[model samples]
Target chain A: MDLEDLYRILRTGHVQAQGIVDTVPDPMLVLDSALTVQSANRAFFRTFAVDRYDTIGQHLYDLGNGQWDIPELRRLLGEVIPKSSAVIDYKVEHDFPHIGKKIMLLTARTVFNPDNVSHLMLLSIVDITDRSRKEAEFEAVFGELRHRLKNVLGLVRALANQTKAEGVSGEEYRTAFLGRLQAVADANDLALSDHGDDSLDALVARATKPFQTAPETIIVEPSPPLTLASKEIMSLSLLLHELATNAVKYGALSAPAGTVRIRWEVEQGDHPLLRLSWRESGGPPVRKPASTGYGTQLIQFAIAYNLGGNVEQNYRTEGFEAEIVVPLERAARPD
Target chain B: MQKTILIVEDEFIIAMDLKVILERLGWRVLGPVPKVANALRLLEDELPTLALLDVNLGDQLVTPVAEALRSRGVPFAVASAYDKPELIGGAVLAGVPNAGKPTSEWSLLEVLAKLSPP
Candidate 1:
């Protein structure tokens, strides 16, 4: 078709030339250099809940219930006027009775018609609230994974140092060393696992998995469930493992007739307290080890250094006694 | 008189190394011992010119030993890989020189110099 024929058909068959922009699905607005609302599409009118016909020839800031920032938009318009294209996340809300929320990502460009004169600034806004919300959620999840992975790595380092001096060159020593190493790994794995509800008993049960077998006597006193912090959980797990190993080797658990008693109780009035005790009796007479070993060091390190808790071990003539004292609410501030 | 020096070290190999080094330095190494109790018992008998102590004797923190050395007026030096200055007790940091574990002959002599009767 010829140019004249195409122009006549578009003008006569379609609605008026000025009314075509009003029917678009995407919310769009046209502005002039004076920051005036030259025209607005029907979608724009529906989005801001304003009459587009009445909004035309009004100031851009006057539309949208005067929520569109006048000075701030002047700055953005300056940029788009020079660059001919700019996009940004924009927030526009009405000052009069809060008409409607216009939180959108908008792109604007300066347009010049065949007249060769810059007459309009065309702006298209897109709702991207869902995308930004998802991005935030993903970031938080990623951060949590990184932190947990680092905690696991730190546990591995502690295990490596704990087992390094055992002199495990031969097969027998190698087997014992590997078993202890796996125990540490297992504790770390449990720490990473989820506890649907906060329960201290369940956590301690998982931590004592390695030493809960026969030939070894382990007892847990009945107590109400308590909440514990992740750091406290990890540190306490390794500390208990070290103690249980020592009990198996030198303390009461080492002997057939010997027994290990684990007891804990929480006290609350003003400041809460979590007190635990490990007593071993009916074993051979206990004597202080001439040399402290890794097991003992690990228990001390975890209690004193990592968890900031108190520990006292007495090698009595009858048996070994260990007590640990800590606050009940481990996740308090400034701790 | 062979002046004695108590070695408060946890690892047997490292204790033996200290004994060898102290003896080679011409000082009598008494009880390259691992525990604090043994060192305390021996301290009642003779006054050592000095002591080479490992800050961490496995589970036994050497704070008590540092205090004992201070009470006896015997000079001592601390040696540990993981010693933090902030966590160190007052006696541990007061006038006592610190040398890391697995020390060289030169640094051992440096520690010995602090024990000299000045």
Candidate 2:
């Protein structure tokens, strides 16, 4: 072939090589034998917020806030490029003079020239900072899920132990246990809203929701925001369930003209505490039970033990009276 | 007159088991009635020798009924999953004693039999 024809062939080969470099999805840099960056593709510019035009002949470390000055990265490029292909992942942080903030992922490899004489290093960078951050968040959620399940199982074991009879079959026991657990879960669901925990407003509302079936049977007083802990919220929820259940059967909810008043306030001043009460009247004459059952125990447990508070349950002539006094610090903040 | 015991339990299956145990012991046994109101109404008409009560009835507390039994001088025992005993004045409870739940048939009847046999 003529020399001019050979020159044209050589020029076409260069164009084809450049075309291959430009089409890659990941950011890349082509460095000469001296390790000076010869060219940067468009993806490199977009990925790293750099100018492809300015990268020509610049050293890799001189660009983009000198993030490449990391000793690890330099060592990787120095020793790793001469032997077999080296793979690495590293995060480089840089602030764009114009763009707010930026993070980058860098991968690089050495390339041999045609005839295997000279060398060139090609860096392939995939920005993965966002993906890594989301992955971390997902792991935290899974951890919390595992913890919650453990707590539920622990409570079920306690319930099973305290029940006097191995009376129900495994299937039936599971169903019944689920029933109560669902009730408690519902209470927790209401108490724990979009946020991780409930605000005082939401917690009271949660306690009052189920009783709304017989509206006005239970009264709730306005109180300030006091974060209730999960344990306190669950205990209080169970108390409301028992009280409302009683109201439905014999107390205010039992009669058309009957009414119940429920109110709460975080006692302030020197000693901050919480006081709540359930007062029922107008349904039937209050008398003591022939035996104590789960409800009574739960009420007592809620007020006296869980909240570390005072409880007074009085079987008055007209209706039943219940009071709970708890310390304010026992509250939970919503997520 | 034979000693009679009335059973008030919220759980149906639980009440049935207790019935078998109480009847096997030669006690004149009435219903395994499942609610506070029903038990109270029944007792208002005919008093039993003793009662076995469960406090939380899913929708009510049977504490008032316990009080009614105390006023009428009838003895009773408690069977429940909850560990508290405020309704029976801890003293009376110590004598009759509540059987904390998930108990076997043997333990259940044993507790029932020990309840001041007439």
Candidate 3:
């Protein structure tokens, strides 16, 4: 070939190679044996936030104020590539002053010239910061889920032991334990439901639905919509279950003519408060129990401690009445 | 004097069950104290022969009480639902006896028998 033709062909090949390098999406660098940057791709300058003037001909460790001087990088380039001719997925994690924290995976290979002597190293960098962050977040979530499951299982075991300790018949224990477990399950379902936050009315309805024998026997008065926090739903469900169990056994729902009225009202002030009442009538004459039972203690504890509320029950001859006053900040959604 | 075993558990039902089991075993059960502060307070007033600790008390870890018992040369066992290696770490907790939760009566008694004073 003529000299002019050869020169044009060589120039075109060089431009084509440069174009391919510049067009590559991943950050890339070509460095000589001395670790001085001979050339870099467009992505390299953009990804590292350095101008071409600041990068070309600069030492790899000196650029970007030594941000690229990672020990892992040094090891891969200094030792690994020399022995293996290439290295892949050499990970480096660092907190750069310009980019905060980043995780990068590097693949490097040595390139040789026509003389069969190694001329330069081609290094490709993949920014895997987001992927690594998502992986870490998934691990944390999985760990938290495991922790919660363990705690729930522990609580269930405690419940089973306490139920057995009541000295009731096997059938009675099964019935009571199943009911308590259902209450817990219901609360969990409500918490994980699509709404995330459930209304107080809906919670009461769900808790008392299984106990209702006939319609209108339990009258729920319409009240202002008050959303309950996810944490409060479980305790409130258990409290309602206890109250309903009492009504069914001895208070109001025991008789055909008995009626139970549940009503609530919100009082707004410097600190809002929700006052809920459970009044029973038309059943057998109510008398104060000789001593509080475990159910009573659980209900009172749930109200007083879990909801940060006060519970007062008065045993009158007509019926049983219980009132609960809860701080809105603890149970209610903010306006 | 009967050897006393201090119980630190947050769950009331679990505490009651542990109290019953320990008492039935002929040991005087001390505080089944629910809170770390209350347990620490009990420690100030009385020194039990041994202690049974639950690793998690609501939001607080039982590390402080564990550390206190270790410094005082008091023998103790941890009863928790969490995996021992994952939840319990550090040089202080190395080799401390652990009873996994939903703990069988036999395992609990075995650990207690080991800790009981001769």
Candidate 4:
């Protein structure tokens, strides 16, 4: 080949190689045997926020005011790589002065000449800061799910044992226990599902769906959209279940013309509050119970104890009414 | 002295069930409080003969309440579904008798037996 043709071919090949290196998504550096920066890719420059003027020919350890002078990096390049010739996925966790913190996986390989003389090391950095963070978040979510499952089973057991079986038939006891168990399971399903719908409306609809005999039997008034935390979902579901069960049996859903209205709104303030009202009408005339039952206590406990909220129940002669007030922040607490 | 027991469980039904069981066992139940703050306040007013702690209370851990019980020299056991003691965390709760939840009357009796030595 003519010298002019050879020069053009070599120039084209150099440009192609540079283009390939620049296209790499991960930060990369070509370091000499003495660990001086021989070259860097576009990603490297962009990642470290440095320019070729300050980076090229500079010692790797001295780059960016010695930010690259990590003890682990020094060990890998100075000692480990010489013996191994290449190190793959060596972890280096460091807090950079400019960039807060980074967890990096470095894959480095020695570039050998035709005579097998290794002069340059190709170091590629895969920033795992975001990936590792997501992994950790997954672990936390998994742990929380396991915890919730255990607690649910525990609560179920407690329900089975605590369901008042005294002076009641075996069949009656079974029905009562099963009803509470169903409430717990339904609540847990709503809490743990990844449907991206944790709205209070969703919880109410799910919890009260089984008790509805007809479309207009129970009316849910159009309420502002409000989301609830898993904990709040569990507590509110149980409360709603208890209230609906009572209504179905005697208060609102028993008679043909019976109806129940459910509505809620957020009260804006220094500490926001969620006020939900359940008013029952058009059923058998209501009378205050002579003694409070387990269901009554459970309804109270679900709000007052579980959510640190207050519940006001009025057994009006016409129908039953309940006002539930929960602190917005408390209701939205992360599980 | 009344055989009073403090119950530290967040779940309303579970706490109520524990109270019923403890009452039936002839132990006067103290506050079956759901929060750490409530339990601590109850402890300030009175120290029960024993305490039963649940590992997680909503968003808070029961470690502070467990520590409070320990420093008061009141013996306690964990009533939780978590089989692993390490996951429960806290030096005070480790190796402490655990009555695994879904706790039967027998399991509770076992924990209660260990909690108090007549």
The regions of model 1 sitting more than 4 angstroms off are: A1-26, A30-57, A64-72, A75-79, A82-104, A109-121, A127-152, A170-194, A251-259, A281-287, A316-319, A330-335, B1-118
* Residue range A245-280, candidate 3, lDDT tens digits: 889888989999999999999898888888989999
Segments of candidate 2 deviating more than 4 angstroms: A1-25, A42-54, A59-71, A85-106, A127-130, A163-179, A195-229, A247-258, A290-292, A330-335, B1-118
Docking quality level of the chain pair in candidate 2: incorrect
Best by lDDT: 4
- Please tell me which model should have the higher DockQ, number 2 or number 3: 3
Candidate 1, what DockQ? 0.04
Chain B TM-score, candidates in order: 0.87, 0.82, 0.89, 0.95
Clashing pairs in model 1?
none
Q: Positional deviation of A228 in candidate 4, in angstroms?
A: 6.5
Q: Which residue pairs in candidate 4 have backbone atoms (N, alpha carbon, C) closer than 3 angstroms, thus clashing?
A: none
Best model number under TM-score: 3
Instruction: Give lDDT tens digits, candidate 1, residues B20-75.
Output: 66788899887766677878888888778888887655456777777888888988
Query: Given the true complex, what DockQ would model 2 score?
Result: 0.02
lDDT of 4 by residue, A1-335 (tens): 99999999999998997899999999999888888998899999888788998998999989999999999998998889989978999999999998779999999999887776657889999999999999999988897778767777778878888788899999989988888888888777877779856788788888888877889988999988887887788788888988988898779788889999999988877787889999999999998989988898988888888677899999998999999999877556222
Task: Please provide, for model 1 over A1-335, each residue's C-alpha lDDT reduced to its tens digit, 9 standing for 90 to 100.
Answer: 99999999987754564577766676888888676887778788776677757788988777655666655565667654576455555543223345433346667777676676656678776655556678889977885565345434433433443364554576755655566566556555554567532345655676566676663477787765666765566556666777777877888877788878778777775667777888889778899999987667666656555344677888887989888876655352221
lDDT, candidate 2, A231-253, per-residue tens: 56676766776677667766767
Best by DockQ: 4
Candidate that beats the other on TM-score, 1 or 4, i.e. the better one? 4
